[model samples]
Target: MKKLSIILLILGLLTGCSEKGTYIKNTTPYDEHSVENVLMSNEHVKLAKVLLYEDELLAGIRVNTFSRFKKKAIANKIQKKLEREYPDLKVTVSADSKILLETEKLINKKSEKNYRKKIDKIKSIEKEQT
Candidate 1:
């Protein structure tokens, strides 16, 4: 019974430490599969919230706990890579929880009438925080 309990504890810890799946919310006509592939390629990225709006691409990522120290570097690298891939669109990638939450809200809202304005507001907030 004690050995079974120890095994169960080990399994629980392993599952808890594993990376979560990525989430991409693309309202654009572009192929979302490509973007998903790009984001999932990085092993450090655990959870991601991505929004592809008109002329802009915003992404908020949560890295593995151990990789938190270099989260900024990771975000920047991904941003640059995405920018290279889609040069016509403005790309913003952040590791902030506020940005992630806001992006998720925008995705769920499904209203494009004020998307540009909201995105700009989020960008300004990001600038202020940095």
Candidate 2:
């Protein structure tokens, strides 16, 4: 009886202390932009793109010619912060080929009449899924 009680106590404690959420198991990285960051950058935020795949997300932010270097640094810092905030997200880089073309296309459309409309469409889709 004493042994049984001790075993149960140990089991209960182990379960209570265990990791609580789903986490990305692999070391692989992904990249995605924080929409808030782009907004904070004011008009200097030339172009930014975010992509999600499975349990990972990726981001790429482009700056105007005069501020190219600083833009990259800021983007990198943001990426690191995001990774810390979302430890379960496999987060990483800027030039991922899978979404590179799509990102470029999105940036090009920024000046289009329907750009906001398209952004709204994307937001709607994300909203529905979440």
Leading candidate by lDDT: 1
User: Per-residue alpha-carbon lDDT of model 2 for 7-108, expressed as tens digits?
Assistant: 999999977544221112222354333434533444544444554444555444454557655765655666677777667765543422333344445545
lDDT agreement of model 2 with the native: 0.49
Q: Which ranges in model 1 have alpha carbons more than 4 Å from their true place?
A: 1-19
TM-score of predicted model 2?
Answer: 0.41
Please report, in order, the local distance difference test score of every candidate based on alpha carbons: 0.87, 0.49
Model 2 misplaced regions, further than 4 Å: 1-44, 95-130
Across 12-55, the per-residue lDDT of candidate 1 in tens digits comes to 99987565777887778876676688889999888898999888
Instruction: Indicate the residue-level lDDT of 54 in model 2.
Output: 48
In candidate 1, the residue pairs with backbone N, CA or C atoms under 3 Å apart (3 or more residues apart, or in different chains) clash, namely none
Residue range with the least summed lDDT across 10 consecutive positions in model 2: 19-28
